[model samples]
Target chain A: MSSLDIRNLEIHVEGKPIVKDFTLNVPKGEVHALMGPNGSGKSTLAKALAGHEDYQIVAGEASLNGQNILKMEVDEIARAGLFMAFQYPSEIPGVSIANFIRAALTARLADNEELDAARYYRRLYEKMDLLKIDRKFTARSVNEGFSGGEKKRCEILQMAMLQPHFAIMDETDSGLDIDALKIVSHGVNTMRGPDLGILLITHYQRLLDYIVPDKVHVMWDGRIVRSGGKELALELEEKGYDWVKEEVAVV
Target chain B: MPATIEQETTNHSIDFDREVGNFKYKEDYSYDAGTGLNEDTVRYISGVKDEDEWILNFRLKALKVFESKPTPTHWASKDLESIDYSKIRYYLSKGQQPSRSWDEVPDDVKETFERLGIPEQERKFLAGVEAQFDSEAAYSNMKARLAEEGVIFVGSTEGLKEHPEIFRKFFGKVIPTGDNKFSALNSAVFSGGSFIYVPPGVHVKQPLQAYFRINAENFGQFERTLIIADEGAEVTYMEGCTAPKFETTTLHSAVVELVALKGARIQYITVQNWSENVFNLVTKRGMAMEDATIKWIDCNIGSRLTMKYPGVILKGRRARGEVLSIALANNGQHQDTGAKMIHAADDTTSNIIAKSISVGQGRSTYRGLVQIPKHLKNCKNNTECDALLINTNSRTDTYPAINVRGNRNSVQHEASVSKVSTEQIFYMQQRGLSEAQAMSLAVNGFVNDLIREFPMEYSVELKRLIDLQMEGSVG
Candidate 1:
């Protein structure tokens, strides 16, 4: 069983601390929701966990299946079974979606072992179909000129294809319509199984209604202040973030 | 992120020096007209080819023209001034006629081309193949079906001697000897370029390919090519060139002229990967008649300095012209390439798309010209030049001269210079590609649109070549 374990992680951007004393763990077969207000450092934590160069880790330990991921490169971290669905997917002009995914899969293979193109395409098409993405999109450049919903769906498509041990979806619902949100949620639900863990980071609690996280945590000022079950999301939605700020102030 | 965030970095200049390989070949030249160019050299070259009197006289006149004209000094790069005419071997040949079969070729020459995969490519897709070693063609062959269809493909010397009636009329009409200094020099001692003629109403479905290799030290390769397509005919010609590395500088100057008659279409493609010590200066132009089309697809890589601008003249009503070029300049190289389009008739159209990449301390320049005179009616022209810089020390420049005087003519010119973004690199790296692979993919992506215009086999080879160039470019 694989897990993403982060303990006492302190991340800084340009020498200014953004995520301080952050600790979270999501084991396989469970989903965790990270709800935070703006400037709460939720996205910072996600990017830092993915080994973004700009997000300097001051003190932290992030392990993937007993492997120290914080010491690895960004790509190494990814190959170690951690996936981050970006808030903004980059537009790689001229690189087809098929080629991008193939490159990722090929990287995981041993040297001198080539990815079987036919099998790879079959799997890719299956995942693409599950996400309601057009089959013609396989030949299109990755996320180039794609609509907002399309970009989000593409990220989910990548997460589904990679089938990582843990996936951190950052604002996967932003810029998505109700139908797109439903499709994305369905994709996420389909990928959630005994071997995969998920951490959904969002500013709003709306996404929680669809994914139905096993645990919900409200973060304030770079640290999680409260944790509860699924009902906590609806309660926080009704009470608004001001209540969380007051609660954190009392703490 | 803002909709449009301009993140411009100040250019950081750095010095870069790369050691070029010094690979040489040991072979006997049956005929070697020693170094230096003069009337004697031109006469000797003509005598060796056993050309007609008019051809020899033409060469002698061109020799005078070459001597009179000075090396161009106003270009973006001053590498032209360094070419020493006296140090260059004017001509060398293996003293054997071009053979129709590979078995008939000299053993050493055949082995060289076999290693370069010329014969294999011909067997797979080409309708004909012409392999030139040094100054003369060592092997030339065409499919029997093509030969039976009245299509003529052979060396220029053979074409002139065997079919002068057809070859003489249009030989230098498209590109005159006095067109440029290099053209003049090429005309004086030119040898071993492909000569093709397509009959009217006949289409050659497969491409005819030519491979040129320069093997001697301090050698100068001056090949002259002429292609003519009759009315309603269509054909495509492709050329590939490479040279062995040498400590001393080598010069390659060629003149290629194409004539597309009424309703005919001709496409010319060149993929040049010369050694770093070679100076490649070429003059290529095409003339399109009524309702005809001419297209030039040129790719330039390697070579210490290259200045080539393939152009077309739309001389008849409703004629069309296009030039698609991709130039890559690695360390210590300069790729100065672009296109020229001349609209001389009403309803003529032309298009130019040029993409260039500069790696390390290399420099690439887009120098182009488009002219639509005042009397031309309903003429249209579009030109786009894009440059990608791969390093902090790399540089690029654009110089486009668009002259549009006609009121009804439509002209559009667009040029862009962009450096490979760090975000792009990081994004690709996140997908598990190494820095070199990411760089290669991004560079390939930048020119992907234009590369699609190439034939399938060429596009694949071009990508492989770019990948090799980008392997060690990033630290």
Candidate 2:
């Protein structure tokens, strides 16, 4: 039951099909790389599974830990242990990072229960120290005036605090430079364990060089065209996605 | 156009009912001036208090002015026509005496104030406390230490009789009867508000608090408050008003005046939570002298229609004034609130920041006025007003009139109206918060800076009031 499974999932954006027959499954304790070029529907699939209102799910089923996720509301789905790190997270002005994460944690509590402030700060500081984020960042507003690298680190910081069962990293490596990439990759590698299954969506194989995935799947034309080990990423990087397109065409 | 009057049944509901200022006890009155507003009603009230001849003439003259002027129908809301002046009880009180101790107060009155958490708050932080029920102050007391420093804090009636040398000078000077129709009515029938005077260089460290409660049906509560801080003195005064829900409409019109002399400071704060059946029309203005500072921290949460624009008149060189306010308007309510700054001398400065949140069909309007005459120099003002509309039906408007004639003066004004974005709401929702909780969080974020300007206890209570009003607001 501790797994993420998507079975023949079909999705449309503004009445046009963007993800077709997306079938994948990742058991807990594994990292899966969803590799694709631009417009290959990797991000659309993540948003659809997370129940974003703009994404339409035409057919098929998506479940997490034996619970149907796409059938629930957005917040309910999140409470059922799903987290998405946006490529461009919003800037919540006037709300500090400490308060924002506290609100999220408070929402997870029962009606009669309350969050222990001292305990929460202790755990938050521990995570921030591990991620190498400055202690003063706690007082700063969430992603407000943050650089691209800082925003991604903030997302990982939230993930570390929330402790979600499964996470979808939507291009977490898109806007980072080489040095920032190393720090972020180290964070992802540290968060990896049997308790959390991750679907890492990326266009290039540069990220896999740092945090190697257990399996890699290539997507093209809104469908998965190839499935292989980490070596497939290097092969695609060498021969490029054109070879996969021709191979799929020949099939 | 004088609109017709009709009694509309209470239709829509839900703004923190039953638990927060929604229960009223029976009324036991020793004096009632009957219904209607006339010369006889004014005379009857003046006679009950055994007022001076000059005070009686002032009341009678104000009653004439009240009858002569009309509601500003051409510019005001149509809801103003719903108020029936002939059917309202003008005056009602148990007695003119305000007990100096809670033990001497009536049981029902003491129970009412206790339930509202008055005495506890007084004991916790206040330097002085005045609890007013219906038409008179039930209990008024100040710390003995403060009294030892020659600080005068008492009901307006007692102040008028005991300290006329100081009270008679600035009684109605700031906001006279003919200033507006409501002010005229309040001047004619004003009762149990606070009167405070701090001596020169005598600083009151803790705030003096007054809590006003309305307990009778179809009665109008008109209180008058005045405070004068002598040269080099500093004081902060806070007041709260609450009333129970009733089927008929209730009117609450008050006039408050403040004076900060040279090198002095005065801060006036109000946290009002009137029921949906009340119409709160108030006039509040302060005067700041040379090198003095005056600040108004107002938070308006509940009422049927509230029209208050707390203003400041800078009357001396190097004087400063500031007004920071937050308002939350729920269904069937309209908050027409803003600020005014009048620069009367050179080197005067003022700043105004107002924020409002409109939920459901509620409406909020920000009307500000800033004036600097051509002869004045080095006058500056900065005005900003922001509004948040919760849903599609929720509405907000802003009208700022700024006039700076002299080339040496500088003024800046900014206004913005934004709706709660679905994306922002969804972002908070995806963080595991319900829709209403998410909305409340965003609103609190919108007004977070102004909330910090409030005192510790009021800020907490204000946040709770905002959360309570945000219930059932999500469409």
Q: What TM-score fits each model?
A: 0.92, 0.94
> Clashes in model 1: which pairs?
none
lDDT by residue for model 1 over A46-115, one digit each (tens)? 8888888999999978898889988888888888888889898888888878778877788888998866
* Model 2 root-mean-square deviation: 6.7
For model 1, the stretches where C-alpha displacement exceeds 4 angstroms are: B1-24
Q: lDDT per residue, candidate 2, B13-71, as tens digits?
A: 11122245778888889999999989899899888888888888999999989989999
lDDT of 2 by residue, A1-251 (tens): 89999999999999999999989998888999999889999989988887889999998889999999887988898899888888888777777788788889989998898777667788888898877899889878788899999999899899889988999999999889988888889988899999989999999999999989999999998889899999999999999989998999899
lDDT of each: 0.88, 0.88
Please compute DockQ, using alpha carbons, for every candidate against the native two-chain complex: 0.33, 0.38
Q: What DockQ does candidate 2 score?
A: 0.38
Least accurate stretch of 10 residues (summed lDDT) in model 2 chain A? A113-122
Least accurate 10 contiguous residues by lDDT in model 2 chain B: B1-10
Candidate 2 chain B superposition, TM-score = 0.95
User: How far does residue B3 in candidate 2 sit from its true spot (Å)?
Assistant: 53
Clashing pairs in 2: none
